[model samples]
Target: MVNIPRLPTATQAPQRPKRTDKQRKAEQAAAPVSQPTVVAKAVAETIKDPAFIEEVQARVQYDSPQGKNKQALSAYLDVLHQAKREEYSHLLGVDFYV
Candidate 1:
């Protein structure tokens, strides 16, 4: 008889137990509401200022990242716009995310 190496079967592999819907719901219910940090709030306030926006617009150089500059600029503009939306942010509900 020839000697054969033993191999583990699928059932022998470790498995992570899936959470039940009730467990998931319980976790969601236990989660705390999210809020912005002081630094983030300060940044939002600074960006909302017309003078700061103008300064940032003037300082943004397309040469910094070539073709990707537009996306970066749009993101920067979005951050500035966030200050205006801060009060209504919670209205986004479940879709809210970082």
Candidate 2:
């Protein structure tokens, strides 16, 4: 047998009226949401992989940007490759040339 007190005793604080699950959710939904700071929001956004979103956003029947952007990617890679080749070109002296 459990001994439950009908009212709060002097040592105990009075409990506020119990709210239903629906009431609690309603109150939460009604409350103003605290917006994240700029840096925090940027971090949260950058952490998310938006590739899937971008792939779907175009709503095209054909291939995604991955395949279509090969030209642009190749162009960038060519510039990078040229820079790296030039950096090591000095090491390839004419003495080593046949």
Candidate 3:
């Protein structure tokens, strides 16, 4: 038999296990409720303001990702976390530390 070149074994970074919907909801529920911060309020207002949104849309030459803005999604999340979400962000995943 002719000699065949050996190939290196493929390797991949381990993926974090996916949490079930129940688990996600439980974690979200476990997250403590806190008062919205002034910065969070400002961000929500700026993103929700019709005039500001319109101005930005007008300025954008390319198409926007959202038809419904749905900007409220992120706005609400930031408000819920008191704008501290980034503090717990890591390479693998989030820790709900906030």
- Estimate the TM-score of every prediction: 0.42, 0.29, 0.29
lDDT of 2 by residue, 34-63 (tens): 988999987788658698568766775755
**With candidate 1 superimposed using the best TM-score fit, by how many Å does residue 66's alpha carbon deviate from the native?**
19
Off by over 4 Å in 3: 1-32, 63-98
- 1-98 per-residue lDDT for model 3 (tens digits): 35457965666899999999999999999999999999999999899889998999888786444645667676666688864555556544776643
Q: Can you tell me which runs of candidate 2 are displaced by over 4 Å?
A: 1-10, 44-98
Q: How well is each residue in 1-98 modelled by candidate 1, as lDDT tens digits?
A: 45457954445568999999999999999999899999999999998899989998998876555567877887998898786667567665433345
Measured by lDDT, the strongest candidate is 1
Residue 27 CA displacement from its true place in model 3, Å: 14
Computed on alpha carbons, the lDDT of every model, listed in order, comes to: 0.79, 0.72, 0.77
Candidate 1 clash total? Answer: 0
**Candidate 3 lDDT (Cα, whole model)?**
0.77
Best by TM-score: 1
lDDT of 3 at 67: 46
The CA lDDT at 1 in model 2 is: 40
- Please report the TM-score between candidate 2 and the true structure: 0.29
